[model samples]
Target: MTVFAAEQQFHDAEASLPSHQARLACRAGLAQTTAGVAPGYIQGNLAILPETYAAAFHRFCQLNPKPCPIIGMSDVGDPMIPSLGTDLDIRTDLPRYRVWRDGELVEEPTDITAHWRDDLVAFVIGCSFSFEEALLADDIPIRHIEQKVRVPMYRTNISCAAAGPFAGPMVVSMRPLKPKDAIRAVQITSRFPSVHGAPVHLGLPQSIGIADIDKPDYGDPVRIEPDEVPVFWACGVTPQAVIAAAKVPFAITHAPGLMLVTDLKNKHLAVL
Candidate 1:
């Protein structure tokens, strides 16, 4: 199906239900981007690792707050993160998951119940989708969502603070916005630091070592009109890239746009 069709189907299903209801749809294999689903609820990016590497990864998030803000974390061997939601299940809640072995993507599974291990730990990182609602509320247009595609993401030359083997270049997601809107976006997003708040870089993608704006390391590229400048923000996907670079024995993350929806509302995340 086309992106538009998938988005339309999601919209049609999501328009009537509460956040939990929408999540149930996702859990039942409605597997589509969680962009507009559960509009008011906070959406998080998932990262699961074994206890052996959990401490290092936790420190990694703390050291690099911009790209990896910890929203919720699971107790060892537990799939439920009570802080995120009353009935959250990390193994089956997300629409899609990417399983890694020795840092290489081994599978993109719909559920990870079978992969769950006794020493496994799950981390719920804050996502940009939490802030997009604020941007939309302020009438700041997000072109990727408007175009029914995933946000464009690029890997930069900027290195993250190394935590054990969990070190790699920062990954960013881009949105094309005019100067005025970009300025407004900075103010709006900055209020929610729990989610990656504000633009890390604006314009000159090459300065960040992005060789081709048309080719993104992750996600589909969106059009960047001449009148608009590209705004880059720290993305939760950074951990996944770091996992590959670190070559950890095993890991799992949410598929790019398929996020984990939580009961926490976006408004609750704002600091101002």
Candidate 2:
């Protein structure tokens, strides 16, 4: 099958399944970015860390609210976070997971069930997928989605306030938009504070320490046309960067663009 045909099939399968079942499919190896999956459902970035570091990480998130908005968290030593979704299993929900050891990526796995530990705490952070859905509703184009690729993410020079071992460069996701559309996006996204709210930086990538517009630190890159400017937003993936910077003994995160499918609807996260 052509890539487009496979893409359509993936979308169709995702559309047919409820959130948990979609997650089950993901566990079964149907790897794809969670971007358009499950329609209105809230997709979340995952971070699982030892309980010893949980408090400091929580504080870190609180200090850097824009990039690390907490959507849901599992009790220490538990795999299930019932508030995020009924029967949610942190080890197997997302399509892919990144296992980090002392700030290095040690594995990209389909399931982390074997890695689960009693001292671990799971965190779910709000993702840009919520607002991207809002943008599409208003007929705004999402270049990465149109190109059938992951959104571009970068590690910027902007630093997060430190909390124990949970400090790092602020990571932002990029979306190229024409000037007028960008203005409208700010208006549309402002309503969703739980999901990173609005753009943090626009136009000049260099201002945020993004050295090259075409080369992103994470996820797939898309074109930035002459008529368009790149808009950057605080991203949930910031935690992974923080984990790397802190060099914690062990950590786990959703692979960039792969998110946990949640029962909570995107509309439920909107502040407006």
Candidate 3:
């Protein structure tokens, strides 16, 4: 199905559910971007690794807070992260998962039960979707949601702080907005530091090493009107890039735009 068709189907079937029910739908095999689902609740990016690499990866997140603000973590070998949701199963709660082996994407699975390992550690990173709710509440237009597509994300020239076999260039999500709205977005998103906080770069994509605005490194592209400027925010997808660069033997991450929905309210994450 086309992006619009898939989004419409997801909207009609599950967009308005509460967090727990949204997860239940994912666990039931409904795979699609989690962008507009469970709007008021917090959503997160997933990264699972072996316990042998967990400490370094944890330090990587701490070193590079903007692109890896951790929201929740699972106990080693446990699929449940009760702080995120009592029933949130790391192996099955996300709509889709990307399994990586030696830095290469080996599979995109709807359920990861077959791949779950005893030494695995799951990390939940704060997602831009959590802050998008605030932007929408403030009347800011989110083009990806309006266009029924995943947000455009690109790898930038900016480098992340390296932490023991975990290092890569930063990745950012973009939203095109008119100059005035871009300013408002900065002010609005800055209040939620845990969810990326604010625009990391604006207007000139080339300044950030993005050669073509139409093509993105990850996620789908959206139109950029002449009156609008593309705003970039650090994305949670940085870990996937790091995994590729580090060439870790094994790893699992939520498919771009697909997330783990949590019971925590978005408002609860705001600094203001």
Candidate 4:
């Protein structure tokens, strides 16, 4: 769950986001926006690269279908990711972005103008939030979204297909749910392939190498009721974890939950 209220706003996107607001926020230096800005819209996980590594990264995403599912991309030196939304500018749509150098986190910036390069390319990936929308549509309660807390995310032992310098374990997001609801979610989410289709693992997290249930590598911890076993899904974090480990000379990604809100509606991606 993300606190839509907790996200700090720079300049309102005239009551819209992703296209117009991204440019506005990037211009204002509000790198991190917390709350869900575009209700009922599809938001994305972001990844940016220089020309030298764009080909390799592109191949990496293609090879690792589940963890790095590509949604939209840009040609080298093009800030406009036309595939996602009309006039969508990659450099300024997301509220926050992470700057990496030599595989190390160097800075967290709202805008990357100082770091932008002609060789740079950007990628937008499918997010689990789209699936969560499906679950909610079925009346399955999401604890974090309801309580305004960050969903728990864990680094797993699952390996991703390596392409060039990119290779790392898959990360997953957790949500607590009753067994019946979890089962139904599996059936409902299987239809949307473009938005991270369904839950990868559902019970006994240790089976996947997550030693501690309460501890998470990203996001915050949520309650685990006795009647509710922890349910896990392949997350957008998988790519970020891989990028951080790969340690490319320079790379950028959206801060967790600070998604690239697109004009695309969640219904547009729904298979039903």
Estimate the TM-score of every prediction. Answer: 0.91, 0.90, 0.91, 0.89
lDDT of 4 by residue, 129-246 (tens): 7788878989999988887888899988777788998888888899999999989888887887777778788887888889998899889989888999788888888888888888
lDDT of each: 0.90, 0.90, 0.91, 0.81
User: Which runs in model 3 stand beyond 4 Å of their true positions?
Assistant: 1-17
Q: Candidate 4: where is the Cα deviation over 4 Å?
A: 1-34
- Where does candidate 3 have its weakest 10-residue lDDT segment? 9-18
Ranking by TM-score: 1, 3, 2, 4
Candidate 1 residue 17 C-alpha distance from true site, Å: 8.0
Model 3: per-residue lDDT, tens digit, 172-237?
999999999999999999999999988899999999999998999888999999899999999988
After superposition, candidate 1 runs with Cα above 4 Å error:
1-17
For residues 173-242, write the lDDT of model 2, one tens digit per residue: 9999999999999999999988999999999899989999889988899988999989999988888888
Worst 10 residues of 2 by lDDT: 12-21
| Best model number under lDDT | 3
Instruction: Give candidate 1's TM-score.
Output: 0.91
lDDT of 4 at 11: 29
Q: Is candidate 1 or candidate 4 better by lDDT?
A: 1
What would you estimate as the lDDT of candidate 4? 0.81
